[model samples]
Target: MREQLQELLEQRVLQCVSMPRNQLHECPGIELKKQSCAKRSAEIVKAKANGRIKRKFENQENESVLYEVHFQYLIKQRGLFYMEEEVEKRQVEFYKGILVSDEKLNEIDGPREDVEDIPVFSGHEEGQERKGFRYDRMKAVQYAERWWNDFNPAYKKFEVDCTNYISQCLHAGGGPMRGYPNRSNGWWMQNNNWSFSWTVANAMRWYLPGSKFGLRGRAVDSAEQLKLGDVICYDFQGDGRFDHTTIVTGHDGNGMPLVNAHTYNSRMRYWAYEDSTAYTPNIKYKFITITDDSDA
Candidate 1:
């Protein structure tokens, strides 16, 4: 019976992935359906037996394939009338019809210089003015701690709030907003609208260093070099696409950055997330240091 059940479980997973895209609506047990989003969802549908399957969609022409599987099964105990449950999980990834390599998966997107020219900062008193503002690390860290869980009424909340939360922390630390009405550049937020850099993880990565004024940061060599209030970006799959961001709030005993983040509502957690499902061996990171705080 156990063998038969195991075979059936495998069959169900196959069926779930093989079902026609149009027929997806008929299968309510499937938790996630977005073709463009790089997320996988699954669940168990039997008594004392649980199963989960995850898959990624590349493009409209490609079929989604099972990438991961998790299952819990009941096993008979030695000389006992009761049964014991055993859990198992498996991960598989393929790229271009070949297995992916850790080195290839860890490759991150390099810095770009295609952003709008940085406005020159003119050092002038009252009558004269500078175009960019400085960043306050202390104020940013304070703001992060203050609103680790609470939502700020001024900004629009997103289903994925990591980048939005980081932007607020940067703004609180005195990062000035530029290009107010324009969404192509700057870090300003008005009503439900905001600059792409202000709310998107990948965009912020490019905007910070590219901007000569307002919010500016330089890339650092290591995570340990980061001070309190520094920012870190994560590329979970290392496909040059950054999907998450976090703020440094504290440090561990070994001096690792302890971070605070939204979306999962974590506070002062360890920076290296080896336990996360999104975590990959090829994970890439970007450490940013806000350089100029003269205005702050």
Candidate 2:
């Protein structure tokens, strides 16, 4: 099922990439490039908001470009039934917050009663396109900014909210939530409005955080002991400050944690954990575990 699903997702992505932009619009429109999906999605919402488009569901020839067949299935099984409504609803609340209408809310109150509301398509990935793929967090942040802006801004926002932002990107990138938490549900929370714990720890499964094991585990006896996707926790000035967090997106050939964080600054960047920019020598470190949810 995973293989089939992955294949379907790949094919959809390729189709979106290979399909001509002009062919993607229902009406005569501009050509959409790979970098423009997020921007376009933002524009669609903006146009609807400005009354340029009278319809909620704009006729999108390129809808096929942004999604995969497997994603559609996942949507039916996971996101779609709730996505259009949930995303619209949350986006409005995040943006407008309590000022949105009860009448508009009523429209999506019930389940999609008709299975026909579900779309159908064969799914498969064409070939390997992972070669050119780089972890372009800056571009991801740009897309995210446009996305977050179209909605309400009352919900807690973070700079190096890398994990949270990545979660959003994954959703935008066509990954289904297997049981993740958002700020609303509180699967994760911030500390004093600015702290991080960029590792995953299920209370039901792991003890005292970082107890859950498997993806990749290593002891960071020194700064040299980290790699991509590895986690970093804070220990404030030896008084035990597990008060901050970040993730390692890459590493130097010598092995240093390339971190992406917010707080001090909002950006995906590289850092030396042992260096005392944010700490002192008495500040001890813990395990920098890793998890690759990509193939999952």
Candidate 3:
């Protein structure tokens, strides 16, 4: 089974590298890559996938097994005047020794429907008192790359941890924490308690732009305008509920940001999640450049 898992990873990489579009209909990522490359007059020159089995469960009752494969795909493309490379890390599940469905378990991040909507904090009305703090973009990117595939012991890990991880990156970059003891208030995670903005994607998405002080954000026009340590929020359903978030860690040859994120746990991934299972044609994105406007 282990050997077959490795073989499957290899075959998937090969398919992405050279398979026809009709044959690769199941691989949306690769198909989207091909479309992107065509638009830019680029061609994929190299591709590979390294797989590590994170967990496996076997059931003798029906000769079936489930394997959680951590897949890291490296792809290189060459255009007329530019060359670029990216790595996408995502966990895949296999059933009965092969993939029964490629749907990711940790993808969507809408508010937990079982619970009532969280209390909202009006950042604009109740402006937070912030001290002078400068954002360290390089340090944030360093922290992002350091822990993209792993969790830090110092922080609590959540099931849908995309925003939690991004908040950590911001903190690592010298972003100050505030609004403690109130989960609905300012961004913070301390003493085992946290703010909604620190863990909830939608909360952070709203908190940043509305925040008047302390680790605020300025919305930009597009992903290209964002610098390292900036953020991109996702509304996969375009229902006005922003769901997932990612921090910029690197940029491609074209200057578009390459992002690092949790939940799916990726690094140097393309900013637009065109291939994500949660993606819809109506997907909306919010490009926010993390700001340190004032300490007042």
Candidate 4:
């Protein structure tokens, strides 16, 4: 019975996580989807000579173009979420829900097939219904830990500098790089001259030329349009200079966006988008977008 239970868990690990095959983190992975703007586009309205309105045949094409980055998220398997109810239930079921061991439940020295009460969780439900909801702050932090674990230590120590570390976290989350080379740029290369593009600004720019990874780059406006893995760069001085980069993890309870960034004060932390009061004084322009360099 015990052996059978172990096998079930192993299978659950594959279905819920699906990491090794997809290059996804076992804990949480970022996903992107299109979000449209609520406000009508300027092209949709026509101004009359007398300030009167007129209906013009503006195509739906412009409506689709009026999208902005409004949603950000980090998705994970439902089974991995630390639900006390589920945990206790599984323990009880595993031990046959009694103080004295029940040989009947473990007749084959493994889990019993009759343990139907055990919670079965999945990331997505049937017909595209989402099984798991947005993870919370604590889960996001845990996801960061999983992300740290998945990073190759050799690459982390040798190829990544301080700025590159921040960039790498964002890259793993889904922000793609551009100008970064995978080979032979001694200063930026490691592991046989594979140098990583460094700094938040430089790393943001790296996607301009595209890399070996298959990453696609697109310019977007507003944090709301961003998905969990999108990269957001800020021109802190509003002088057309992008000085900072951060990765969007997901949304908070109030629909405020959350971001993960490093090196500003040395530790990676989540920042809320609505709390502009903290850094709005220095922020000039905010550009959020999704880039995919996986092809390179």
Candidate 5:
């Protein structure tokens, strides 16, 4: 039974690379159907999947087993003027050696709502010109690439960790932290506790422009205006609430951003997220350009 499960897991891992058109993360118990996107032209040149058993147990009648697998994907992609490789990962659950559900592990845990009001920094003069820290785009991008599919021991890993991961990348770029102990105000993570803006997608999306000190960002009109180390907020439901976040780590030949995220564990993925299972035609985005003292 173990061997049979292992073989099935391996075959399922390899199967994701076989169909690139859909790219949508499959929910448990649903067969992924290919959907056409007009802007998708990048071709996947090669692909492979690797899976490992995370846990397993016997079912009620002992007729089958229930278990979880950590599935990882390696893909080589080609575009009009570029060729690059990416490593993406997700988790899957199986019952009785049959695939039941597959998705980014803990998709339900992330992208929290804005439950608290962050107070404004009294020391900051909103209208007055202020010099900020130098944001290192290269360092941020490097950090994104280094840990896209892995978790750092310094921080707590969440089941839905998109915003937390993006905050780490911003910190790598020299974004300062303030408002410790005040979980509703400012953006700082300390002693296993963090501000809403530090870990919540909706909070960060709102806190960026209004913030006067520490990890501030200016709202942008389009994704194209963004450069490396910038952030993008996703309102997947298009109900005026943000649910996910990603960082710009690279770009495609057409100058579109190639983002890295944690929840789905994607690397060098298209910024539009048309491939995401959460994608909807009504989906909206908030583009943020990380500003530094040089902006003055």
Candidate 6:
């Protein structure tokens, strides 16, 4: 079942990549549109099975299964005469399911839904200082701006190091670690090992809101509301699967957030990320307001 689902997703990705601009408007289950910009190219970064659900058929030998796959890709564009290139990161969810027959599968409604609304996190208690220590935001931003290009030798680095770098900045700014020895929960790093929240984008999404004592964050409505030392998470595919993270270091003259990130190593870059190939019209964002223990 998993293999079949994977094959189906791969085929859809190929279709999106090969379909011409004229035909993209007519393609089913695919979204392609021309931007105001010129030049064009496409690339798939990765795809993976995230989860599954099974429903039993009454008195039947078989069951219905729904599989969720996360797909990440990039689209690049340039002017007709200009050599400069801009890339947008994109992600989309593909659902593959098996029923009694192809007819039954065809009867499923909508097959997919728009990006799920971000879960709401409760506000901090009135006048109550949060538990744990606080780090200096200026220091965290300094670290991010200073080390985005240089690797910190203290921790292990991966080819995809965005989340790891963000975690370091948050720590430097005084976010405390919890749930040590349990990689599935908490945010901690010791001896080259770290929690999933410290290293994975999706895990950190849940961790920040669910945390009670360490590394808590309050969700804001938009990027404009985020302050320096805050964080932004991206779901290029709008599938509720966050794949990238960045730290706010400064705001532009227009008060737009400017961020620093690793993996691609950007410094004081614009937060909108319109230049990334992974970007899409359906992109989703999470603006996090890091809570400090010193606030009362």
- Please list the residue runs of candidate 6 whose C-alpha ends up more than 4 Å from where it truly belongs after superposition: 1-131
Q: How many residue pairs clash in each candidate?
A: 0, 9, 0, 40, 1, 18
Ranking by TM-score: 3, 5, 6, 1, 4, 2
Global lDDT of each model? 0.60, 0.31, 0.74, 0.33, 0.68, 0.62
Model 4 TM-score is 0.37
Better of 3 and 4 by TM-score: 3
RMSD of 4: 25.7
Misplaced by over 4 Å in model 1 are 1-130, 293-296
Q: What TM-score would you give candidate 1 relative to the actual structure?
A: 0.56
Model 2 alpha-carbon miss at residue 59, Å: 55
Quote the positional error of residue 11 for candidate 2 in Å. Answer: 51
| Candidate number of the best TM-score | 3
Candidate 6 is scored at a TM of 0.57
Instruction: Indicate which candidate wins on lDDT.
Output: 3
Q: Tell me how many residue pairs clash in candidate 5.
A: 1
Clashing pairs in 1: none
lDDT of 4 at 49: 11
lDDT per residue, candidate 3, 1-296, as tens digits?
56766787778767766888777677766777677655644566666665555555556522333334454444444432322233343444455455664433435544542133566573633455655588899999999989987899999998678899999999999888888777888889999988888988778888888877778888989989999999999988788777889999877667888898987777877788875767899999999998884423
After superposing candidate 4, which stretches have Cα over 4 Å from the reference? 1-152, 156-163, 170-189, 192-200, 206-213, 264-282, 291-296
Q: Whose lDDT is higher: candidate 2's or candidate 6's?
A: 6
Residues 40-72, candidate 2: write the lDDT tens digits.
221122111111112232233211111111111
Candidate 3 matches the true fold with a TM-score of: 0.83
Task: Name the lDDT value of residue 189 in candidate 6.
Answer: 90
Q: TM-scores, in order shown?
A: 0.56, 0.32, 0.83, 0.37, 0.77, 0.57
